[model samples]
Target chain A: MTEGLSEAGLIAVVCEACGAPRTPIGPGDDAALVIAPPRGRQVVTTDALVEGVPLVEGVHFLRAHPPEALGWKALAVNLSDVAAMGARPSAFVLSAAVPEGLPAAWWGAFARGLAACARAAGAALVGGDTVRSPGPLVLNITAWGWTEGDAVLRRDGGRAGDALMVRGNIGRSTLGLLNWLKLAESGWGVDGAVRDDALAAHLRPAPPLDAGPWALAHGASAGMDLSDGLATDLPRLAAACGLVLEVELAALPVDPVCAGLTPDERAAGGEDYGLAVLVPAEHVGAFIARGFASLGAARQPVGGERPGVLWRRHGAPTELAASAFAHFSGG
Target chain B: MTEGLSEAGLIAVVCEACGAPRTPIGPGDDAALVIAPPRGRQVVTTDALVEGVPLVEGVHFLRAHPPEALGWKALAVNLSDVAAMGARPSAFVLSAAVPEGLPAAWWGAFARGLAACARAAGAALVGGDTVRSPGPLVLNITAWGWTEGDAVLRRDGGRAGDALMVRGNIGRSTLGLLNWLKLAESGWGVDGAVRDDALAAHLRPAPPLDAGPWALAHGASAGMDLSDGLATDLPRLAAACGLVLEVELAALPVDPVCAGLTPDERAAGGEDYGLAVLVPAEHVGAFIARGFASLGAARQPVGGERPGVLWRRHGAPTELAASAFAHFSGG
Candidate 1:
């Protein structure tokens, strides 16, 4: 039998271990308080991971991995939104509608996972509400970040001459998801280290959070996370700026772990949690020189902005379709 | 047939109409940005309203009221948390797990109600995420506030003999819930104005957000919202302060709307988003001088704090029971 630590004990443990260094008031009261910025701005965003949908029955989350990984993914997805904005991840609050009668250790592992992710991102789990539900897991997390001065990023600033660039590796999670679900048999013949990593990526994503502010400093005009497939998400930046993206097939970063997959299969894959940006054609050189070096070390001319709806990649034109996870319409 | 607006269009309407006033950056890009405070602190708290649990199918929310009122109550409950901290509500992010195939009009009314409550609280609906669920509505709202310096009020700083004080009316929502549920037949023969007001109180709760900062300014030691009925919640403040509270039963404010109710039921019914405070014997005069007037003029010599587990009120000792809406543990 798992010894169940009450909710109060769980809160106290997390507070002491993942104590905030930046904020003045730390969670003990009805709410937690963060130190307000002087001339800077604060960023906020919210996202949810329902138990059944994203984490299908024995498909994505709960049944496949450790409880800690599920908690990590919960906060990591929201952090991806903060990273999409050119800012430093600061603090977050989690509202969990958990199933009734779970053991104390389960919550301990979950909070530990959240704290580990928060510690890595220089963030703190300030405060949140917990309630019991018969439903599977209805976890909603709201993340915030600090942006210095007026230097914030948006997804609609792409110009007709701007180039669409990815801040990090893509499609690991899509393949990772397939790998986790044991549904992929792509004839890549690459296994061993790469296969395990892809499986791990689906459980815990490492978004290119640092690239956001760096790109903003290096003159990034538009930016967003590549949680949705690039085939759809990149065009969103283009659509926001009233232009089409001309993407080169070979230019998109392909993780060795997800090799031999079709370009559309990977590019249109969801749950990658990577960062995508648009840089003006002239400033592209500067962005490469000063932006992210790890990604730039192996970069290509992925795409450019155009005044048409057709998105060209490789040699063929791809339609600007709805995002991979578009809710109602089955596009 | 109810026409559903596309997610993008709905986002646009919410951004334009429910625009933020306090934050420097409003919702449009990847996230909403708020201007950082110079020397103050930012407060955050989260709460949720499940469809079937808190608001039954044909009772509390969906059946008894308009969509706008439901939206108002959603944000209002979170505002009560900010009020409990003696902080001004600043900004909030809402993550709504709405059912699939809902009409566009539903989202519009919800956003309008959120904006209206935000305007009243001097806060903003900065940003949020909307997802589709086949299940009931699961709305989670996380609110932020700006508190000056280190003036945050907690619920654990009471000394023996400190007077337990309430900021406003109590038991309105509890009785109002009964009125909404058609359970209470404690006939006072009152109709028209009082009847409708009680029902309205349960639908769109107006937390005394003003009393927070006011009480903090006037030498308040401890405070929190009376959300879980005074019987259960006051003991929590007493327990947090390591003392027992002797509340005066007849002195508790009885709403004209909830007339002819038993003292136990009125004071112990939950969902009244009023503020309760603990003021030391010496500073009681100053608290009244600068604190809320409505609670001040009709105040009584409610129970003094004692160093024991026993709490007394209305002549006999009051046993602290779990709130009516205590999620689990069978009440």
Candidate 2:
């Protein structure tokens, strides 16, 4: 039998290990108090991971991987939003709805994971609430960051003729998820290094933290974190800016792990957690020099064409599958 | 057949109805950008409400009450934490996990409730995320507020001789929960007005938002919101300050709806959502004049005594039932 710590003990562990360094008042109070962002602008975003929908398919996601990874993904996803806005993360508050009977060690590792991620981002875990749930674990994280003056980025700031660029791997997380499902269903196997890389991609996504601010400083017009696949997310950026995106499928920097996957499959894969930006055509060379891969360009709508994505394979017009990641649509 | 809104439609509704007023970059972006607290200090807190816990006994609490009320309570509870910290709420981000098939009208009402509460607090609903859940509905709210220059309150700021005081009705929420359960279980009944009041208490808790900052400005030593009942929360304030709390039960401001309840039962109840503070003995009169009720005082331990609470009746030592609301303990 495992000895599980009480809620109070878990709170104590989190406070001791993950307390905000700049916070004047930390956890164990009604609310945590932290120094306000000095820039006079605060970037805020929230995201949640439910137990089984997208992570592990059928099993409890926490049990599928190390609990620390779940904690990392939970906070990292929200941090991706802050990073996408060209802001520097300051603090976060987490509210977890956890079922009873999870081991105390699981919580300890979870806190350490969050602490490690926060430290990497120069952020602090300022406050959290945990409650007993009769359902699967739900982790919701709200992260805030600081943006000075007019440095904040937006997905709708793109102009016609801006080049669409991406930083980080595409479809690796999808490959990872497929491998996990295949292994569980049919004993599918891969090389140890490939398996580890794919699993890490799915479980502990490393968002391109510095790219958004750097791009903003270098004249990128619009940006978003690619949590959903580019197939799904690119259209959203296009629609927000009231333009059509022309994507050159052959130009995509596909990951080696996603080799052999179709271009459509790679483009539609979710959970990539990368950075997608729109930069002026003139800055494309600088962006490429800084490791950004050009995918395509935004264009003015032609002949009343609604905002959408237009994929071009081998420099000709093409059609890709629609995004299949609509929440609550159950499609 | 009832129609349900897709997640996109729901997000549109929330953005239209509850978008932050002070936010320059509102929802629909990767992240929202709002003016940072000008006071240089920020207060942050989070809370969650689940499906089948203390709210409505065994049924889905959301179904038992109006969805609007549940939404109001969810945000209100977090607002209570902000108020307890002597800060003015500025913005909130909500993460909701909803099962498939909840009606569109349910979500509409929920958003309206949230908007009403945000309006009352002079705050804004800045951002949110809605995810599909395979289990119970869980609503987690993270709210933030601004505090200027040394005005924030903490539970550990009490001195030994400070009077323990409370504002707002005690045990009303417990009364509400009991009435809800009794009406469902044995058909035990109450008058229409009483039932309405009790149900409202449990569902839409109007926290004493003005009391905390007022008390802090008026020289209160320490404070916290009475979330988990006096029996549980008072001792927490005492323990934080290395003192023992002495409660005068006969002087408690118990709700009239809980008239027949035992004093111990009233004190042991949960979800009062009121302000509890330690005011200096000299300023107790002013606090009383301003609608606070005297309940007890904090005192130093007499002989190597651990921080705890003592009950007194008729000016003599007595015993009260220990708090029964322990999260994750399943007690």
Candidate 3:
């Protein structure tokens, strides 16, 4: 709280709050030294967002979107990466660039959002940098988490005989986005809950924290987050497993909101934020029951051992056109 | 070197290179686990820079400063924080926002700079985020480092009788800047070494890494870096020590190139990148001798216990009329 305290002073206060275990050397030396735990491996990831690229002033969120949401989203997306790895979140560092003369209230809201997300994710906002910019707001969040045992999931771990399963119903978040776009285009303001769900999905996506751990614990062969929409995400999973997945269209769990959408729209829409897992054929049923209980989502097998996606409709499977969603290429 | 690998992929590779030691249970599960080292103490700091703010397009550098230098500078400035703590440098993360269509060379250079600085500082580039922006380049580097001993030197640690000692000559970097400005103003091209030194000092400052450990090891009572002009930095040291620093201007080791400058110009100049220490009276001589040897600078007692900065002109001490540089205040 003191004014003009150098960066070191600020660090001292934050360090006290962190209360990291002591080593032969700690933060005040040339390089900190820590004893690595015997079994756990350090995992790290980074994500960066530019104001106009991934987020346009009007398209990503309303122009009046709160700075807190911006900050929260920045941290949340990176947390999603940790979730994709089936790893726990640990510490995070933020790097932000905002236009000069932005209100201090905005900064405060941003920090508050960061704190809220860090608390919810059980991670610490350990350190970060802020700078002035002449362009759109840009933020990058770097996260570090650890995991022990073979629970670590990678995109390249699925097997040919693996049964495809997902943590939750897909398309809800995508539907939320479509609903917002429709309302915005029609000049009709949607209801608060619909707006909230859509905005929240767009701004503060809920990464499947529990699902990641549960899948890891239950022997998921391969897993990843449904960030780029199922059509795109599934192929990556299949490729990683060194096989092809014949997705049955009838078994695809479409959200009621997405039911009315055209097939192409449903296939290509993104922002799902769900976890997809590959389970051995034998454990499919048990994983469904246990995983649903643990993750609060019905883990349905959406695909078979054959390569490529097959959409099932009216009790019959049909081959789909494309494998995934490309952000720039219209589906 | 491969393209198409996302930021997360790059970090995974680097983490592997650094030897992924077992971390706590958090990282690979849902978040990360960063145990507060045994001591309930930590140090934290952040810094940010926008392209137009600290660096104007053509004015900052010719050939458009490499993205690598930008990245290196971002991290180096923060490393200066760790150095000031007399602490060891540890881990760092970077967040960057660059304009769209920026060459891949820019990204590569930026990453190389980050890696080079991290390696030199003995810290690992653990993670970071990158995104496209419509604005000028923006970079933020957040670094974490620590010390083993609890007696980390602080700005407020100076005492009444502590002898003021500085590592490295002051004003060279400032002189370099003035030369560059002159060249720019006059359209006069300069020698390569002068231009390189000026740009390098401004772009990729070499923080005194060993000085911190030496000061801590030798029992320095108080210390900090000369980021702002000595005149301003000295006042801060005085305020922190709760005593006045009576600096003898004649004895001040101004770089020979800066000797003929006006008093105000000489006093308020910055970018020295030198360490300043307040040695206790009992250890003054030894501290100066050892500090000089370690820092490769000639040491002299600038002033004794006094109320304020005093200058010597023609063998007698005289009070100067001007104050030190204030970065935000534009003094």
- DockQ (CA atoms), all models: 0.47, 0.60, 0.27
* CAPRI quality band, candidate 3: acceptable
Put down candidate 2 lDDT per residue, A1-331, tens digits, no spaces.
1247666676677776676543236677889987764554788999877787444242326454567777777888888889889887888888877777777777777777787788888888888887766877788889988775656888888999999999988878877776676665654343222337777787777888888778878899999989878887999899888999999988888577778577777788888888999999999999999999999999999897999999999899988745433320121
Best by TM-score: 2
The candidate maximizing lDDT is: 2
Residue A313 lDDT in candidate 3: 51
For candidate 1 chain B, the 10 contiguous residues with the lowest summed lDDT are B292-301
How far is A285's C-alpha from truth in model 2 (Å)? 3.3
Please list the residue runs of candidate 1 whose C-alpha ends up more than 4 Å from where it truly belongs after superposition: A1-24, A53-66, A101-108, A159-161, A183-195, A280-286, A289-310, A313-331, B1-24, B53-66, B101-108, B159-161, B183-195, B280-283, B289-310, B313-331
Model 2 residue pairs with clashes? none
Please write out the lDDT profile of model 1 over residues B119-167, one tens digit for every residue. 8888878887766554566788999887776678788766666677786
Instruction: Please give, for every candidate in the order listed, the TM-score of chain B alone compared with the true chain B.
Output: 0.82, 0.89, 0.75
TM-score of chain A of 2: 0.89
CA deviation > 4 Å runs, candidate 2: A1-3, A13-24, A53-62, A105-108, A186-195, A321-331, B1-3, B13-24, B53-62, B186-195, B254-258, B321-331
**TM-score, predicted candidate 1 vs. hidden true structure:** 0.82
